[model samples]
Target chain A: MTDTSDLRSPTPDPYLSMDLLRFTTAGSVDDGKSTLIGRLLYDSKSIFEDQLEAMETSSKARGDENVNLALLTDGLKAEREQGITIDVAYRYFATPRRKFIIADTPGHIQYTRNMVTGASTANLAILLIDARKGVIEQTCRHAFIADLLRIQHIVVCVNKMDLVDWSEEVYQNIVKSFREFSSRLQNIVEVTFIPASALIGDNIVDKSTNMPWYQGPTLLYHLESVYVGADENHVEARFPVQWVIRPHSDEWHDFRGFAGRVAGGVFKPGDEVQVMPSGFTSKIKAIYSMDEKLEEAFAPMSCTMTLEDEIDISRGDMIVKPNSPPEPSQDIEAMICWFSSGKTLSGRGKFLLRHTSKEVKAMVREVKYKVNINTLHKIEDDLEFKLNDIGRITLRTSAPINADAYKKNRITGSFILIDEHTNETVAAGMIL
Target chain B: MNYTITHLKQLESEAIYILRETAAQFEKPVMLFSGGKDSIVMAHLAKKAFWPAKVPFPLMHVDTGHNFPETMEYRDAFIKEMGAKLVIGSVQDAIDAGKIKEESGARASRNGLQTYVLLETLEEGGYDAAMGGGRRDEEKARAKERFFSHRNEFGEWDPKNQRPELWNVFNGRKHFGEHFRVFPLSNWTEMDVWQYIMAEEIPLPSLYFSHERDCIIRDGVIMAVTDCLELLPEDVPEKMTVRFRTIGDATCTGANLSTAATLEDIIAEVAAARQTERGTRADDKRSETAMEDRKKAGYF
Candidate 1:
């Protein structure tokens, strides 16, 4: 449990023991997603005096009736002038229980890439639904994308309670409709509902007094207490080698360590490991995190491992327990979300596929189908994969890729396709 | 702690992963070390990322010729201790070569001129990637920056056309003339940097700690009395206990009045600080889109 003994105090180090929560906010135009984020930052006292003063001046210049909280976001000059978020913007704040990183994304239907990019690393997602509109097509699209990204927890903020007269029946109805829509999403572990008024400061940082029928925690409270400890897969031991560390200096001339971030499970010094692609087995001599020799390392920990046997190993090799090895195949099937607007992904197209630390040239054998995110249906007739389109594809790689299903390991299961001619990242792929 | 990693540890690991990725992806990678706390943390993470092996790339500093004397001292000591190569891009050299002009007067600062020197240095070194310590929480414009920020041949940032960065999969692909500016500390906040500095026990310049210095209050900001800064007739210098929240050109970086001498004290002071760290940076005060304008022109 998080120690909130000194919840709001500045004594004895409140930051050392605190955990971190990274979440994404998704809502359509004027649904108050940015306003909700601004409220969270403002009410938490995260916005400094200078920032607030600047925001106030800008708000007045833009002829806003109130100090526009949404202006706190929309960083780029283009974004500010257009009054819309063109790309993903990251915002940071902290409470006594946790530090929060909010990936604030735009909600326009055309800006689906921004939403996907923001939802990629988030542990939780905040989908704001206008109390009047209830669950709309944009809400379903956001929910579907969040589910496709495998976000564990989602906090559905039914905002604009003030506009809806703080009606409990309205909030309940929206909750029911959202449940019916979200039941089709298979990957979300938890869905929580809260009534909020970002403009009126209700049920965001503090519990709303107007909505007394709601007994759930505030948005901030839910964000602080959400269980994301088990989000990383700790069952499969997978370590994709990122670099080969070797120093020729006299102090340590013979040290050859394999450096990588652990993707899954716990790895100890005496654990027997297998090198992927080569299938060579070796025993771990030691694990060193910087200068200290760690007894054990696990998922998400960056460490260097020295093997007892000096086998031919380099970057792009995976070190794992010999008993459970990932499927090594040249044929790959994955769900890809296209990102490039200048080019469209076509069948029989060839590109560079990067997964883990390995890079292989892959040719698309076929376009399986494109997903209609709002409807949650796969369209089989249209095979054209354009910008912001989520579809499945089969590809044959130049070399065998050792990968796990995206459901099992996010690190090893994810890949990106890069256009050979333009060198732009065309699509993000999830291994099936 | 229940076997879970602390936020600092997690941030450190993420940064290390990025540093490693930069080294593996780019042909000629260099770290833009500004002798600030953020850059210090990046260098330390780079060391940890490739243990036993020396940091693969050189450390480059665009010398504004108006830096704190303590910064240079610390920079030399740090590079020598790490046994890493050092590359200097001198703004003074650019001025001397008639490529850029040095601003004159009380408000004159080489802060804006460092961009030209930095770009020239990157081009001269043929570096395809330069790692920075830029954080999203520092400024408004920086909030939208990616971990792998691309630059055109002219070294300008196209914010609207930025590539989509997802998960931990960073796309470093670029054309021949294009290069990437990689920021490993993009997710960290100012408070996080201080906490990580405390946890790692990394050494910093004494300017960060409280010291007695002659300063003049200009527009509600405390500016350290430096030789490069031309004093106005109405300016009066007074000795006070002050510390620097950020280290930029001596002409532009402001000193905050504080008695926080130790890292613990600094952390506490930062927690209680109501002003953003960049509030002291006079360069950013020029306009609302100051950072954005400079960034679009390839400013670090």
Candidate 2:
């Protein structure tokens, strides 16, 4: 065996720790969404004895027959008492193959904000479809939201299959109809259809022998094996300097490096990079992962880089490839999901626009149109954007933010609008 | 970015990003080090975040006064080695100043008292951001926490109206006098932490390893017979091989009967262990909403 050693080597138990999948579950409350997640956690051996005991105790106290698995996710006291999920509750489960973080969200029109919040960080979204209800409005709404967030993998769990006798005809009909509707959604790379009964263990962890005609993998199997390596933007190079590291000590008097997680593309020691807002070009001298120097560094890695030239660079300044630089502009158009309770966008109204590492003053120049998520219809002339509203709007920023189209580079293209007075995050915007 | 990293490295990057966000977004920030494994790991990440520069923030410890001497020693050594400033908000001082009252009897502990001291310190220091080692996997209430948890002027958490965090961009903007409790270890599980510690070769207090300690079995949990503890008439100490899964207040933290002395042994035990690290503590057993209420009132 070739001996390879580095400052940061893989842990001894890499099998249990390497792969991680973050997914969100979405649907109407009665679609067995909670039960599906509960089954996954229960079967994956993620549930501890004390937690199960507490759930059983609560099940008894509530007179819930046969131990309601759905009760496992109701973490807050109000949620447990009111039987309504208020926000997204994250649950962790791991198998021998991979680890998973489940962002379980509430399903209600009023809780659309909650669903969007959960779906933002998910690589895959499990859209639970009630076998009886078929393709409902909530199903369409959830898929549209997931697609808007650019979640690549979509696992459509046609739950409550037992209610439909696990019939292949029903499963096929639902799958065919869903595919027809999902074709309209953009940026969803993969969609999986599985007939499962979350109430009883079926096609979740164990293959359901009842569905003899279904040859696809189980829900848990797909989650463990789904490919997520190419999810990040690898073409455009974007590195926003988060902090400048200058030791002000005698140990390394001239040591100066830019500390940041790579936003897009790959970077090497001799790569030519152009600093944003200042137009200073320099070659990267070295990359360091702590005390160890590396030949190359890439996206999402937390290594610091030093440049050949002593150019002035600070937080909010992006270092991009000189070959193709990010567009620096003061005016932009975007699709935003309004997260504020109050109607806060207007031509003259100002908000803090946080894009990449820079925060600038921005105002909505115009609200062009609002897309009705359920029907996927655009409603024009709706100039006012309210809470949980997804609409296309034009904005003017006080200063130029180096950015790209959201579809091209998510890290640089996406931003959030923060309120100036209350300091609450009011909206999530994607540059169009 | 065009890079693919291991899960441990991804976690480290995410944590370091959060620390940098806290430093860049806030006026004044402090990392809350409890002398626990999570805090130790967090401190280590902070060191790596801005390598060439001194850590942009100081560390604050809400000392309960009922801490194991080993933890105190470890905290001091860690501060010295890392060259991080330490701010100790003492619970004893809070009680002595008549700002809070002390509890008595078998259930007496400074675990809850640390909350008052912590809030007082945050207010006194005008700390705009307080980085904590609280992990979501530790408790039910904490599971819903954001990487940047915002608190009102009173430093209270509104579980109902938490800001939605998306991508790597965290919204840390807050009103004057309000601060955020940033949990860099929000996504980390206990197993992940132990695995990272072993991979990083981070040092921990001796209390984490199994050793001959005087302990007593109370309410089905092993309570270490430390000098900070107040024993009852029915409670008696016996020599037993024990190790603490977690370290907090001496009275509330429980030790497990084991001989898993090394880091690998602890990792295996944590993997096979049936209960959560917090499951053994008596503090969360107070009520169904014990942790929830404490969190709402700004408890770390």
Candidate 2 chain A, which ten residues in sequence have the lowest lDDT sum?
Answer: A1-10
Candidate 1 lDDT, tens digit per residue, A137-221?
9999999889888998999999999998999999989989999888888899999999999888899988889988999999988
- Candidate 2 yields a Cα-based lDDT of 0.87
DockQ of the two-chain complex in candidate 2 = 0.61
Model 2 per-residue lDDT tens digits across residues B1-300: 324566677788889989988898899999999999999999999988888678988999999888899999999999999999999999998899999999988878787888899998999998999999998888888889999999999989999889988888999888888889999998889988997898778999999999998999888989988787878899988999999999999989999988999988898898788888888899998887899999999998
Model 1 misses residue A141 by how many Å? Answer: 0.5
TM-score per candidate: 0.97, 0.97
Each candidate's interface RMSD, rounded to one decimal? 2.7, 2.5
How does model 1 score on DockQ?
A: 0.65
List ranges where model 2 is wrong by over 4 Å: A1-12, A15-17, A344-348
CAPRI verdict on model 1?
A: medium
Report the poorest 10 consecutive residues by lDDT, candidate 2 chain B. B1-10
